[model samples]
Target: MNKAPLITKMLPRKNSLRNGGELDTKQLLAALMAFRRGDFSARLPEDWTGVAGKIADTFNDVIRTNQRMTQELGRIVRVVGKEGRITQRAALSDVSESWGDAIGCINVLIEDLLRPTSEMARVIGAVAKGNLSETMASEIEGQPLKGEFLRTAKTVN
Candidate 1:
Protein backbone atom coordinates (compact mmCIF):
# COMPACT_ATOMS: atom_id res chain seq x y z
CA MET A 1 0.00 0.00 0.00
CA ASN A 2 1.07 3.57 -0.65
CA LYS A 3 0.55 6.56 1.66
CA ALA A 4 0.80 10.30 1.34
CA PRO A 5 3.47 12.26 3.21
CA LEU A 6 2.54 13.41 6.73
CA ILE A 7 3.08 17.10 6.00
CA THR A 8 0.92 16.86 2.89
CA LYS A 9 -1.90 15.46 4.97
CA MET A 10 -1.72 18.57 7.20
CA LEU A 11 -1.78 21.12 4.39
CA PRO A 12 -4.97 23.00 3.56
CA ARG A 13 -6.54 22.64 0.11
CA LYS A 14 -5.87 26.31 -0.69
CA ASN A 15 -2.84 28.43 0.23
CA SER A 16 -4.51 31.85 0.60
CA LEU A 17 -7.39 33.10 2.73
CA ARG A 18 -10.37 34.89 1.17
CA ASN A 19 -10.73 37.36 4.04
CA GLY A 20 -8.07 40.08 4.44
CA GLY A 21 -8.32 40.24 8.24
CA GLU A 22 -7.71 36.50 8.69
CA LEU A 23 -4.58 35.76 10.70
CA ASP A 24 -1.85 33.80 9.00
CA THR A 25 -2.66 30.30 10.20
CA LYS A 26 0.49 28.60 8.91
CA GLN A 27 2.47 28.83 12.18
CA LEU A 28 -0.44 27.62 14.31
CA LEU A 29 -1.17 24.82 11.87
CA ALA A 30 2.46 23.75 11.74
CA ALA A 31 2.74 23.78 15.52
CA LEU A 32 -0.42 21.73 15.91
CA MET A 33 0.67 19.26 13.26
CA ALA A 34 4.04 18.85 14.96
CA PHE A 35 2.29 18.34 18.29
CA ARG A 36 0.07 15.67 16.78
CA ARG A 37 3.24 13.90 15.69
CA GLY A 38 4.33 13.74 19.40
CA ASP A 39 6.70 16.69 19.29
CA PHE A 40 5.99 18.35 22.61
CA SER A 41 8.56 21.03 21.81
CA ALA A 42 6.46 22.39 18.95
CA ARG A 43 5.40 25.99 19.61
CA LEU A 44 3.72 28.72 17.59
CA PRO A 45 5.47 32.06 17.03
CA GLU A 46 4.80 34.32 20.02
CA ASP A 47 5.77 37.37 17.95
CA TRP A 48 2.28 37.37 16.43
CA THR A 49 0.18 40.30 17.66
CA GLY A 50 -3.33 40.59 19.19
CA VAL A 51 -5.49 37.48 19.40
CA ALA A 52 -3.10 35.40 17.40
CA GLY A 53 -0.29 36.15 19.83
CA LYS A 54 -2.47 35.28 22.80
CA ILE A 55 -3.52 32.02 21.17
CA ALA A 56 0.06 31.12 20.35
CA ASP A 57 1.24 31.93 23.87
CA THR A 58 -1.52 29.86 25.39
CA PHE A 59 -0.72 26.92 23.12
CA ASN A 60 2.95 27.17 24.01
CA ASP A 61 2.14 27.27 27.68
CA VAL A 62 0.04 24.12 27.38
CA ILE A 63 2.80 22.27 25.57
CA ARG A 64 5.38 23.36 28.14
CA THR A 65 3.11 22.34 31.02
CA ASN A 66 2.54 18.91 29.51
CA GLN A 67 6.25 18.49 28.99
CA ARG A 68 6.93 19.42 32.60
CA MET A 69 4.32 16.95 33.79
CA THR A 70 5.85 14.22 31.67
CA GLN A 71 9.28 14.91 33.09
CA GLU A 72 7.94 14.97 36.61
CA LEU A 73 6.12 11.71 36.08
CA GLY A 74 9.33 10.09 34.91
CA ARG A 75 11.10 11.39 37.97
CA ILE A 76 8.31 10.06 40.16
CA VAL A 77 8.57 6.63 38.59
CA ARG A 78 12.32 6.52 39.05
CA VAL A 79 12.20 7.72 42.63
CA VAL A 80 9.42 5.37 43.68
CA GLY A 81 11.03 2.43 41.92
CA LYS A 82 14.47 3.01 43.40
CA GLU A 83 13.80 4.69 46.74
CA GLY A 84 10.25 3.44 47.32
CA ARG A 85 9.12 6.98 48.02
CA ILE A 86 7.47 9.84 46.16
CA THR A 87 9.87 12.49 47.39
CA GLN A 88 9.12 14.98 44.61
CA ARG A 89 5.94 16.56 43.25
CA ALA A 90 4.92 18.12 39.95
CA ALA A 91 4.49 21.88 39.97
CA LEU A 92 2.63 23.44 37.04
CA SER A 93 2.23 27.22 36.97
CA ASP A 94 0.32 29.62 34.69
CA VAL A 95 -1.52 26.75 33.03
CA SER A 96 -5.03 26.96 31.67
CA GLU A 97 -7.96 26.17 33.98
CA SER A 98 -8.31 22.61 32.72
CA TRP A 99 -4.62 21.88 33.09
CA GLY A 100 -4.71 23.26 36.61
CA ASP A 101 -7.44 20.77 37.49
CA ALA A 102 -5.55 17.92 35.84
CA ILE A 103 -2.40 18.77 37.78
CA GLY A 104 -4.33 18.89 41.04
CA CYS A 105 -5.88 15.52 40.26
CA ILE A 106 -2.51 13.96 39.54
CA ASN A 107 -1.09 15.23 42.81
CA VAL A 108 -4.05 13.91 44.74
CA LEU A 109 -3.79 10.52 43.05
CA ILE A 110 -0.14 10.27 43.98
CA GLU A 111 -0.87 11.15 47.58
CA ASP A 112 -3.76 8.70 47.79
CA LEU A 113 -1.64 5.92 46.29
CA LEU A 114 1.19 6.57 48.75
CA ARG A 115 -1.08 6.73 51.76
CA PRO A 116 -2.18 3.09 51.52
CA THR A 117 1.34 1.85 51.01
CA SER A 118 2.63 3.81 54.03
CA GLU A 119 -0.22 2.60 56.19
CA MET A 120 0.28 -0.99 55.11
CA ALA A 121 3.99 -0.77 55.86
CA ARG A 122 3.28 0.50 59.34
CA VAL A 123 0.84 -2.29 60.01
CA ILE A 124 3.15 -4.92 58.58
CA GLY A 125 6.04 -3.72 60.74
CA ALA A 126 3.96 -4.18 63.83
CA VAL A 127 2.84 -7.60 62.64
CA ALA A 128 6.44 -8.60 62.08
CA LYS A 129 7.06 -7.96 65.78
CA GLY A 130 4.20 -10.38 66.61
CA ASN A 131 1.75 -7.55 67.28
CA LEU A 132 -1.03 -8.83 65.01
CA SER A 133 -3.53 -6.56 66.78
CA GLU A 134 -2.13 -3.48 65.02
CA THR A 135 -4.58 -2.26 62.40
CA MET A 136 -5.20 0.79 60.21
CA ALA A 137 -7.23 3.33 62.15
CA SER A 138 -10.17 4.98 60.48
CA GLU A 139 -8.96 8.21 62.03
CA ILE A 140 -9.65 10.72 59.25
CA GLU A 141 -12.83 12.07 60.87
CA GLY A 142 -15.49 12.01 58.15
CA GLN A 143 -13.35 10.03 55.67
CA PRO A 144 -12.98 6.36 56.50
CA LEU A 145 -10.56 4.25 54.50
CA LYS A 146 -12.09 2.18 51.70
CA GLY A 147 -11.00 -0.11 48.85
CA GLU A 148 -7.96 -2.41 49.12
CA PHE A 149 -6.55 -0.59 52.12
CA LEU A 150 -9.68 -1.29 54.09
CA ARG A 151 -9.61 -4.92 53.06
CA THR A 152 -5.97 -5.26 54.00
CA ALA A 153 -6.57 -3.63 57.35
CA LYS A 154 -9.36 -6.08 58.07
CA THR A 155 -7.16 -9.02 57.15
CA VAL A 156 -4.31 -7.71 59.25
CA ASN A 157 -6.48 -7.27 62.29
Candidate 2:
Protein backbone atom coordinates (compact mmCIF):
# COMPACT_ATOMS: atom_id res chain seq x y z
CA MET A 1 0.00 0.00 0.00
CA ASN A 2 2.74 2.47 1.02
CA LYS A 3 5.88 2.53 -1.21
CA ALA A 4 7.41 5.71 0.33
CA PRO A 5 9.59 3.84 2.83
CA LEU A 6 10.69 1.31 0.22
CA ILE A 7 11.81 3.96 -2.27
CA THR A 8 13.56 6.02 0.43
CA LYS A 9 15.50 2.98 1.66
CA MET A 10 16.79 2.33 -1.88
CA LEU A 11 19.07 5.43 -1.92
CA PRO A 12 22.61 5.60 -0.48
CA ARG A 13 23.48 7.82 2.48
CA LYS A 14 24.62 11.34 1.68
CA ASN A 15 27.69 13.07 3.06
CA SER A 16 26.19 14.14 6.37
CA LEU A 17 29.09 16.54 6.88
CA ARG A 18 27.80 18.78 4.10
CA ASN A 19 24.29 18.40 2.80
CA GLY A 20 23.51 15.83 5.47
CA GLY A 21 21.44 13.77 3.07
CA GLU A 22 22.95 13.05 -0.35
CA LEU A 23 26.50 11.69 -0.54
CA ASP A 24 26.98 13.40 -3.89
CA THR A 25 30.02 15.69 -3.88
CA LYS A 26 28.78 17.91 -6.67
CA GLN A 27 27.35 20.34 -4.17
CA LEU A 28 30.63 20.45 -2.25
CA LEU A 29 32.63 21.04 -5.39
CA ALA A 30 30.28 23.71 -6.60
CA ALA A 31 30.41 25.52 -3.26
CA LEU A 32 34.19 25.35 -3.24
CA MET A 33 34.36 26.70 -6.75
CA ALA A 34 32.05 29.52 -5.84
CA PHE A 35 34.34 30.44 -2.98
CA ARG A 36 37.30 30.41 -5.32
CA ARG A 37 35.44 32.77 -7.63
CA GLY A 38 35.26 35.54 -5.04
CA ASP A 39 32.07 34.40 -3.38
CA PHE A 40 32.34 34.24 0.41
CA SER A 41 28.64 33.88 1.11
CA ALA A 42 28.55 30.08 1.07
CA ARG A 43 29.74 28.32 4.22
CA LEU A 44 30.78 24.69 4.37
CA PRO A 45 29.06 22.49 6.89
CA GLU A 46 30.81 22.15 10.24
CA ASP A 47 29.21 18.81 11.16
CA TRP A 48 32.23 16.71 10.20
CA THR A 49 34.39 15.44 13.08
CA GLY A 50 37.86 14.85 11.63
CA VAL A 51 40.46 17.13 9.99
CA ALA A 52 38.07 18.11 7.22
CA GLY A 53 35.61 19.54 9.69
CA LYS A 54 38.36 21.48 11.45
CA ILE A 55 39.51 22.91 8.16
CA ALA A 56 35.98 23.91 7.29
CA ASP A 57 35.56 25.67 10.60
CA THR A 58 38.75 27.64 10.04
CA PHE A 59 37.71 28.55 6.53
CA ASN A 60 34.32 29.82 7.71
CA ASP A 61 35.92 31.91 10.44
CA VAL A 62 38.36 33.50 8.02
CA ILE A 63 35.59 34.25 5.57
CA ARG A 64 33.41 35.80 8.25
CA THR A 65 36.20 38.02 9.51
CA ASN A 66 37.28 39.14 6.07
CA GLN A 67 33.69 39.81 5.02
CA ARG A 68 33.14 42.02 8.02
CA MET A 69 36.34 43.94 7.34
CA THR A 70 35.48 44.39 3.68
CA GLN A 71 32.01 45.63 4.54
CA GLU A 72 33.32 48.12 7.05
CA LEU A 73 35.89 49.34 4.56
CA GLY A 74 33.23 49.86 1.93
CA ARG A 75 31.06 51.82 4.32
CA ILE A 76 33.96 53.99 5.44
CA VAL A 77 35.01 54.69 1.88
CA ARG A 78 31.49 55.52 0.76
CA VAL A 79 30.91 57.90 3.61
CA VAL A 80 34.27 59.60 3.63
CA GLY A 81 35.44 59.48 0.04
CA LYS A 82 32.22 59.58 -1.93
CA GLU A 83 30.00 61.63 0.35
CA GLY A 84 32.71 64.04 1.50
CA ARG A 85 32.14 63.05 5.12
CA ILE A 86 35.79 62.89 5.99
CA THR A 87 35.16 62.66 9.71
CA GLN A 88 33.83 59.13 9.41
CA ARG A 89 36.23 56.30 10.38
CA ALA A 90 36.13 52.54 10.06
CA ALA A 91 33.96 51.10 12.84
CA LEU A 92 36.02 47.94 13.32
CA SER A 93 37.06 48.30 16.96
CA ASP A 94 38.00 44.72 17.89
CA VAL A 95 40.21 44.14 14.87
CA SER A 96 43.77 42.84 15.32
CA GLU A 97 46.81 41.66 13.36
CA SER A 98 47.19 42.98 9.82
CA TRP A 99 43.54 43.95 9.72
CA GLY A 100 44.06 46.30 12.63
CA ASP A 101 47.12 47.77 10.96
CA ALA A 102 45.20 48.35 7.74
CA ILE A 103 42.32 50.09 9.51
CA GLY A 104 44.71 52.26 11.48
CA CYS A 105 46.60 53.28 8.37
CA ILE A 106 43.41 54.23 6.56
CA ASN A 107 42.25 56.38 9.46
CA VAL A 108 45.60 58.10 9.63
CA LEU A 109 45.45 58.70 5.90
CA ILE A 110 42.06 60.36 6.28
CA GLU A 111 43.46 62.75 8.84
CA ASP A 112 46.41 63.55 6.64
CA LEU A 113 44.13 64.22 3.68
CA LEU A 114 41.97 66.47 5.81
CA ARG A 115 44.88 68.54 7.11
CA PRO A 116 45.55 70.44 3.89
CA THR A 117 41.88 70.91 3.18
CA SER A 118 41.26 72.22 6.67
CA GLU A 119 44.22 74.59 6.42
CA MET A 120 42.89 75.94 3.15
CA ALA A 121 39.39 76.34 4.56
CA ARG A 122 40.71 78.21 7.57
CA VAL A 123 42.77 80.62 5.48
CA ILE A 124 39.96 81.20 3.01
CA GLY A 125 37.34 81.53 5.70
CA ALA A 126 39.44 84.11 7.51
CA VAL A 127 39.96 86.04 4.29
CA ALA A 128 36.21 85.95 3.60
CA LYS A 129 35.66 87.37 7.08
CA GLY A 130 37.78 90.40 6.11
CA ASN A 131 40.65 89.54 8.50
CA LEU A 132 43.07 89.82 5.49
CA SER A 133 45.93 88.50 7.68
CA GLU A 134 45.35 84.73 7.32
CA THR A 135 48.28 82.79 5.88
CA MET A 136 48.71 79.09 5.05
CA ALA A 137 51.87 77.32 6.14
CA SER A 138 54.17 76.15 3.34
CA GLU A 139 53.93 72.70 4.79
CA ILE A 140 51.59 70.77 7.07
CA GLU A 141 52.83 67.91 9.26
CA GLY A 142 56.31 68.33 7.71
CA GLN A 143 54.93 67.54 4.23
CA PRO A 144 55.42 70.27 1.72
CA LEU A 145 52.80 71.16 -0.81
CA LYS A 146 53.48 70.17 -4.42
CA GLY A 147 52.21 70.91 -7.92
CA GLU A 148 48.59 72.04 -8.08
CA PHE A 149 48.17 71.95 -4.31
CA LEU A 150 51.22 74.15 -3.80
CA ARG A 151 49.97 76.54 -6.46
CA THR A 152 46.54 76.68 -4.81
CA ALA A 153 48.11 77.19 -1.40
CA LYS A 154 50.20 80.03 -2.70
CA THR A 155 47.18 81.64 -4.34
CA VAL A 156 45.08 81.25 -1.19
CA ASN A 157 47.83 82.53 1.07
Candidate 3:
Protein backbone atom coordinates (compact mmCIF):
# COMPACT_ATOMS: atom_id res chain seq x y z
CA MET A 1 0.00 0.00 0.00
CA ASN A 2 1.09 3.64 -0.51
CA LYS A 3 0.54 4.07 3.26
CA ALA A 4 3.30 1.51 3.71
CA PRO A 5 5.73 3.79 1.81
CA LEU A 6 4.92 6.71 4.06
CA ILE A 7 5.38 4.57 7.18
CA THR A 8 8.62 3.20 5.81
CA LYS A 9 9.83 6.72 5.15
CA MET A 10 9.02 7.60 8.78
CA LEU A 11 11.51 4.96 9.80
CA PRO A 12 15.07 6.23 10.07
CA ARG A 13 17.35 5.56 7.11
CA LYS A 14 20.25 3.14 7.54
CA ASN A 15 23.16 5.25 8.73
CA SER A 16 22.13 8.09 6.47
CA LEU A 17 21.30 10.85 8.88
CA ARG A 18 24.21 12.86 10.17
CA ASN A 19 22.88 13.16 13.69
CA GLY A 20 23.35 16.79 14.83
CA GLY A 21 26.11 17.60 12.34
CA GLU A 22 24.07 17.93 9.14
CA LEU A 23 25.03 20.69 6.73
CA ASP A 24 21.69 22.37 6.65
CA THR A 25 21.00 26.08 6.82
CA LYS A 26 20.43 25.81 10.53
CA GLN A 27 23.83 24.16 11.05
CA LEU A 28 25.54 26.74 8.87
CA LEU A 29 23.94 29.62 10.80
CA ALA A 30 24.89 28.02 14.11
CA ALA A 31 28.48 27.54 12.98
CA LEU A 32 28.69 31.15 11.83
CA MET A 33 27.23 32.43 15.06
CA ALA A 34 29.66 30.36 17.10
CA PHE A 35 32.55 31.68 15.03
CA ARG A 36 31.37 35.25 15.50
CA ARG A 37 31.49 34.69 19.23
CA GLY A 38 35.13 33.62 18.98
CA ASP A 39 34.41 29.91 19.19
CA PHE A 40 36.28 28.11 16.43
CA SER A 41 35.25 24.64 17.60
CA ALA A 42 31.92 24.59 15.77
CA ARG A 43 32.71 23.41 12.26
CA LEU A 44 30.48 22.64 9.30
CA PRO A 45 29.95 19.04 8.22
CA GLU A 46 32.31 18.44 5.33
CA ASP A 47 31.21 14.85 4.77
CA TRP A 48 28.35 15.87 2.52
CA THR A 49 29.48 15.78 -1.11
CA GLY A 50 28.75 18.88 -3.22
CA VAL A 51 29.57 22.56 -3.48
CA ALA A 52 28.36 23.00 0.09
CA GLY A 53 30.80 20.36 1.26
CA LYS A 54 33.68 22.04 -0.54
CA ILE A 55 32.83 25.37 1.04
CA ALA A 56 32.60 23.75 4.43
CA ASP A 57 36.01 22.17 3.93
CA THR A 58 37.51 25.51 3.04
CA PHE A 59 35.89 27.24 6.00
CA ASN A 60 37.09 24.52 8.34
CA ASP A 61 40.61 24.93 7.00
CA VAL A 62 40.54 28.65 7.74
CA ILE A 63 39.27 28.03 11.25
CA ARG A 64 41.90 25.40 11.92
CA THR A 65 44.65 27.70 10.62
CA ASN A 66 43.46 30.62 12.76
CA GLN A 67 43.22 28.45 15.86
CA ARG A 68 46.69 27.08 15.31
CA MET A 69 48.22 30.55 14.92
CA THR A 70 46.36 32.00 17.89
CA GLN A 71 47.40 29.13 20.16
CA GLU A 72 50.99 29.34 18.98
CA LEU A 73 51.17 33.10 19.52
CA GLY A 74 49.62 32.75 22.96
CA ARG A 75 52.14 30.12 23.89
CA ILE A 76 54.96 32.33 22.76
CA VAL A 77 53.57 35.26 24.72
CA ARG A 78 53.30 33.19 27.85
CA VAL A 79 56.74 31.76 27.48
CA VAL A 80 58.50 35.01 26.67
CA GLY A 81 56.50 37.55 28.69
CA LYS A 82 55.30 35.63 31.72
CA GLU A 83 58.17 33.20 31.97
CA GLY A 84 60.73 35.95 31.24
CA ARG A 85 62.31 33.80 28.56
CA ILE A 86 63.24 36.40 25.98
CA THR A 87 64.93 33.73 23.90
CA GLN A 88 61.61 32.07 23.09
CA ARG A 89 60.46 32.60 19.49
CA ALA A 90 57.26 31.79 17.69
CA ALA A 91 57.92 28.77 15.49
CA LEU A 92 55.43 29.23 12.69
CA SER A 93 55.45 26.44 10.11
CA ASP A 94 53.20 28.23 7.62
CA VAL A 95 54.66 31.70 7.59
CA SER A 96 52.87 33.52 4.79
CA GLU A 97 51.75 37.12 4.25
CA SER A 98 50.97 38.98 7.43
CA TRP A 99 51.23 35.80 9.46
CA GLY A 100 54.92 35.64 8.75
CA ASP A 101 55.20 39.37 9.27
CA ALA A 102 53.51 39.19 12.66
CA ILE A 103 55.68 36.32 13.87
CA GLY A 104 58.78 38.04 12.59
CA CYS A 105 57.77 41.23 14.37
CA ILE A 106 57.32 39.39 17.64
CA ASN A 107 60.69 37.68 17.29
CA VAL A 108 62.28 41.00 16.43
CA LEU A 109 60.70 42.61 19.47
CA ILE A 110 62.14 39.92 21.69
CA GLU A 111 65.55 40.42 20.16
CA ASP A 112 65.33 44.18 20.50
CA LEU A 113 64.43 43.87 24.17
CA LEU A 114 67.22 41.40 24.86
CA ARG A 115 69.89 43.30 22.97
CA PRO A 116 70.29 46.18 25.38
CA THR A 117 70.54 43.87 28.33
CA SER A 118 73.16 41.81 26.57
CA GLU A 119 75.16 44.92 25.57
CA MET A 120 74.95 46.34 29.09
CA ALA A 121 76.17 43.09 30.57
CA ARG A 122 79.04 42.85 28.13
CA VAL A 123 80.14 46.42 28.75
CA ILE A 124 79.82 46.10 32.51
CA GLY A 125 81.72 42.84 32.54
CA ALA A 126 84.50 44.39 30.56
CA VAL A 127 84.60 47.33 32.93
CA ALA A 128 84.67 44.93 35.87
CA LYS A 129 87.73 43.37 34.34
CA GLY A 130 89.45 46.80 34.53
CA ASN A 131 88.92 47.50 30.82
CA LEU A 132 87.47 51.01 31.11
CA SER A 133 87.99 51.50 27.38
CA GLU A 134 84.95 49.25 26.78
CA THR A 135 81.87 51.45 27.17
CA MET A 136 78.18 50.73 26.68
CA ALA A 137 77.40 51.71 23.13
CA SER A 138 75.44 54.96 22.80
CA GLU A 139 72.74 52.93 21.06
CA ILE A 140 71.67 49.32 20.74
CA GLU A 141 70.05 47.97 17.59
CA GLY A 142 69.96 51.58 16.29
CA GLN A 143 67.68 52.63 19.19
CA PRO A 144 69.37 54.91 21.65
CA LEU A 145 68.94 54.15 25.33
CA LYS A 146 66.45 56.35 27.17
CA GLY A 147 65.63 57.29 30.76
CA GLU A 148 67.49 55.34 33.42
CA PHE A 149 69.27 53.13 30.89
CA LEU A 150 70.75 56.18 29.18
CA ARG A 151 71.82 57.62 32.51
CA THR A 152 73.51 54.37 33.49
CA ALA A 153 75.21 54.07 30.15
CA LYS A 154 76.56 57.61 30.47
CA THR A 155 77.79 56.96 34.02
CA VAL A 156 79.47 53.76 32.93
CA ASN A 157 81.08 55.47 29.95
Scanning candidate 3 in windows of ten residues, the lowest lDDT window is: 14-23
TM-score per candidate = 0.66, 0.71, 0.65
| lDDT of candidate 1 at residue 11, scale 0 to 100 | 46
Regions of model 2 farther than 4 Å from truth: 1-33
Better of 1 and 2 by TM-score: 2
Ranking by TM-score: 2, 1, 3
lDDT of 3 by residue, 87-140 (tens): 789877865998888889888878877787788889889988989899888788
Q: What is the lDDT of residue 116 in candidate 3?
A: 74
Q: What's the lDDT of the predicted structure labeled candidate 2?
A: 0.78
Task: Give me the overall lDDT of model 1.
Answer: 0.72
Q: Number of the top candidate by TM-score?
A: 2
Cα deviation of 6, candidate 1, in Å: 30
> Candidate 2, TM-score vs. the true structure?
0.71
Per-residue accuracy of model 2 over 78-117 as CA lDDT, tens digit each: 9999999988987676668898998899899888778888
Candidate 1: pairs in clash: none
Residue-level lDDT of model 1, residues 41-155, one tens digit each, is 8988767656566677889987887788788767776776567767565567666688777778877777877777777789899989999788877543356778776777677
Error of 3 at 28 (Å): 2.5
